[model samples]
Target: MVVCFVCGNMTAGSNVTQLFSRSQRTQQTPFFPFLEYHDPAPGASPMGDDWSVDACFVCDALLAQQWESFERGRMPIGKRLYWLKRPSGCEIRQPVSQIELEEILNEHSRGNLDDYSDDEGGKSPESKPQDPPDDTPRLICYSCGKSDKDCPSMCPVHCKPSYEQLRTGVPYYPTVLDTDKSPGSKVVCESITFLCIGCLPKFPPEWHAVQKDFLRQESTQSVLPRIPLPEVVSCYTCGTDVST
Candidate 1:
């Protein structure tokens, strides 16, 4: 199900999608669809890094106006538009004025922006937990987006990855519970591991056997530890160039 990030109006239908340049051409008549937000990598195509957001048609139009007014000719829809700052010198990474959008849509569209809302049947909303504002990279539960702040007792579980990726980068992340701890059998001394919160109870049991087969395919694979372990073999003599 697609949900409008601004007004919180969700629909069962697929979202509308169009190119960035095309939307620029139809400035006054921007396509009103559930747009997807993307922060293009640095040095992407020209104008690719412009700040954009995923919003419904109504919200997108509002965002477009705000963007064009502030940026003159640019529409803040699918780019990294700005690096907002606060009075105390703390930087804020607000992609757009989401609060204003909520206020505007409160009287127009479905303004049920609460992600944790429940239905009349007492069922929880399908919305996923939103990430906290602090952007510092850290391990989080793969199932639920909980961090050490909430799920302090997380476990480390490795998920099997393509034979190629296994050669590089540590895939270990924190999982909230032990059930979501481990996935496939150990492959390549180190591969991608999942840190879920009991969300996967024997979830990828199929991978257990698949990884076993990987063992046969390759006998020896290098292990790349995410955190370096204490040196097992160090120079016995201080700064020795040759062993005597």
Candidate 2:
């Protein structure tokens, strides 16, 4: 039985003839009769009624190809079952042939493959080569350098010592640095530190919060307790100490 693609209804054979006639007459109009038609009842399968359904055979074939491609992957059994449910439409009177489907699939696949090949051809030298490693190491702040060891630091003004001091709790002055020194070389450096609390690129804001919380917890645990006094000694009148 042919299914009506538009309304997904089980159309009678007579209705199919009527629709075909209407479609032929309305060919010049902007509206496609198939898209406009809808089934009156919901959840009705279109297999029982024989009707000429309106559908783009090419589009249907492509959709089938897409489904087949995805099915080959490690999809869950439940998902595969769910996707197997056919559309609630009458069976297509003139469905797309396997030969036509194959032709369209090949054409599309070739175009896509060509596009991918072109993209790969346009890649930069760094992305293409997988051989010898570049020995150049990036210098970053001593505090932030532990995790992001290879990232270049914005600390051109201060050397490792100054950078360490600033991270340890010292307030940094941007204008006082003579030259920036690193694993590379020593050069005259301006000590301008613009630490953006909001625009941190390397570490996410949440990570910083987590790190701060950890540090606070560690500090609370590491604090030394004050020693208790054994006795109090005081003299009011003579200003001399007396043990009690």
Candidate 3:
């Protein structure tokens, strides 16, 4: 079994899409060409070193469809949102109210959405803005800077969320890269991102053929389509794998 870095879902090893840094890809799997740091996925900073990302079943298809675009120097990322069904209660994220969501969407559109909280300048608030209680920590996406988990108050992840993420509207989760038990794990805004769930992925008209192509991208042989496992979901929480 492997864990996907994008949506944090569990997948069988054979059904995964492994995106290696240029060097790693050339050395391990050369079936596909690799992209250099000079051009990373849209809105993401240059990947600094050799690293790899695992995409689960659904995310793999999404990537395969975009592989051609990547070759064209346009790497689209952090542009979609997915809802994970958590049957049991979630510990890290709380339901956000509609009003709070609007503030996150409309007001920040003109300015940098990722700039919602500027901590530098060491200035104090002129007046206490009407917000949820201060205990719940704040989380903003490094990509699109959209949805977040918070109490009517606040919430916190492995670490504090930051205000430096680029706005790509893609749901980014820093914790998704590692198991929740990994040390130094934290969910900072610069390391996380959330897109408005409203934006949907555009599936091609010949969707079934595309899905078949996706499942076989790594090899010519067809593999079973990967299904969502509600039993295991990486809660956008502190990057921990949560089993419902």
Candidate 4:
């Protein structure tokens, strides 16, 4: 299902279409189609094979206005576009490909910075600021626009109150009892293994709640109690004494 990247509104079969400029002469294409364009990369080209469109017509218009301000020199190119939903912050709201930015940097590196120099034969005041590396990862949520740093410690979806919570004074707490705590409970490890948040699969709604509870409990139990081990016991069969 194609949903608006900004508002999450259903876009399938909607008359609304976002026009993406291909070139000065070429006509802008209706990019709201679900069959070919949706969930494109951070800076995917509109005419490329991997061209994906996430914003709906509404967002596209809003972005266009922002880009107009950018063009008017009223906004810095490096400044984050307020209406664009993508965290990459590479969206220029224009047809200009990201390669153009790279070429500007390349020319400057070759001591040909004069190529982009202003009319006074110096660096152009209108020259855009360089963007960050394309591979830089965004730490924002896919569903909500909030950054991971801004999001709550628990998953937002799982934290939503359910009907049961509304009916009763106590809220429901879910646990994934079927999930194994440890592959081998007897096994001990010196260090913890970690998985990237991106690598983790989309967990079920209850799983998130369970995970939150588990973490809370683990935090509480992190300080091991001062219980003493029992005194050494003797084995009756072999008459061997063992320490517990």
Candidate 5:
């Protein structure tokens, strides 16, 4: 059994059954559309029955609901969080802690969240500032650099957890895309980006490419430097075969 990415529990009950059935609708189901890369090889065998993810049943259910809410404009898409029942049956929506959130925002705004997470643990003690209290004024949205209060009522997906994200968070994995490489090439982000369900397709489809370098562009942020590709053949850590 795979652990759910959001609630960190084994997906149980009807959630598992329904998710598995939906996956069966296609040989290789597209659960995370934004992360999709690597076109199927010429005459590659169709994928068999396999439905795997790290989200619990409850969290998956919430994600399904959020997709509908986003399409209908009933809720701010990826900008907000939703409540979920953990495996222990606790109902909650957990956001990044204020201190952690500040660190994330600062690092990402500097275009180096991935670098920081890679080379060190957050910021240095002297560099780290005190987190703002709950009542503090909001910063501009990371994607648009506009105040949600002043801007039109559009979904606000921040680079990191802002006050609004604390109220309406969702789980996401970090990834990078190579807009400059040959078709069907991309790289997983060295940094993690926790995103809400509705923001899955947030990136422009035209921008992704399968390439040797890792590239990324968020909302309106300028693209970061290209990262070198990882070794193919077999991942020494995960033992999964990787082909280029």
Candidate 6:
């Protein structure tokens, strides 16, 4: 019998059947575009079969530090507190109080809503003042000192037409191409903006590379493989195949 993660119950329901089927599908079947994680029905929290847990970079770092502390026999109080302070966005439970240690077998238990409310109400003594908003356009291309205006020719690198023009579908530049240039060989202005001389891409190359790597890692780590459906087999007592 398979166990449910959320309620810790042994269920012989279709949910467990479906989970095993999904696992088989991942191992044997081809990939489908539409397949994705489906949440349990409203008010019906399934056990170990459907739910999954994924860790972010911050959580992974915190876990590593905590593990080290465990090895040293000196529990890291700060690391534990950091996890308690934020939402994990996971179905897994977390220990909320010392009293739970006696009742719970797992290291992590479901966090108490009451504890969260108490933490929010208690304010730290060293809160900093909020900063005022800066009216100036925040984005400034390194190649050009001038702030990108809400115009077609604003950007030097990407030919991003003004946001207003894009939304309104109004032509910002009369024509993208210069009249003097040759027909086929001439540079055609698709959008009004001038190209950026230095770093024109939306983000710096290094930052983009880092972002892509992070996305790849996150996707691989977080995506759970689907199980395949069980084969239709006839019961020994009956001739007819049993439907799930």
The C-alpha lDDT values of all candidates are 0.41, 0.36, 0.39, 0.41, 0.37, 0.35
Candidate 4, superposed: residue stretches over 4 Å from native: 12-14, 19-50, 74-76, 84-118, 122-244
TM-score of 1: 0.18
State residue 115's C-alpha deviation in candidate 4, in Å: 11
| lDDT by residue (tens digit), candidate 3, 58-101 | 86666555544443442222222223222233233332565653
lDDT digits (tens) for residues 88-144 of candidate 2: 543434325766534433443343344333355746436565778766544334233
Ten contiguous residues minimizing lDDT sum, candidate 4: 186-195
Q: State the displacement of the C-alpha of residue 179, model 1, in Å, after optimal TM-score superposition.
A: 17
- Model 6 lDDT tens row, 88-179: 33343344555543333222212222322235564544668888876555344333344444322444332234554444443333332322
Runs in model 2 lying further than 4 Å from the true structure? 1-131, 140-170, 173-189, 192-244
**Candidate 5 at residue 13, lDDT?**
38
* Per-candidate clashes, comma-separated: 14, 9, 15, 0, 13, 26
Among these predictions, the greatest TM-score belongs to 4
Model 1 per-residue lDDT tens digits across residues 12-106: 43562222322333244332222223332222221223323333465555555654564444333333243221123223234367765343323
* Model 4, residue pairs in steric clash: none
Residue 27 lDDT, candidate 6, scale 0-100? 47
Summing lDDT over every window of 10 consecutive residues in candidate 1, give the lowest-scoring window.
Answer: 39-48
Query: Which 10 consecutive positions of candidate 5 have the poorest summed lDDT?
Result: 33-42
Which portions of model 6 show Cα errors greater than 4 Å? Answer: 1-123, 138-149, 157-244
Alpha-carbon runs more than 4 Å astray in model 3: 23-50, 70-244
lDDT of 4 at 42: 38
Evaluated at residue 141, the lDDT of candidate 5 is 29
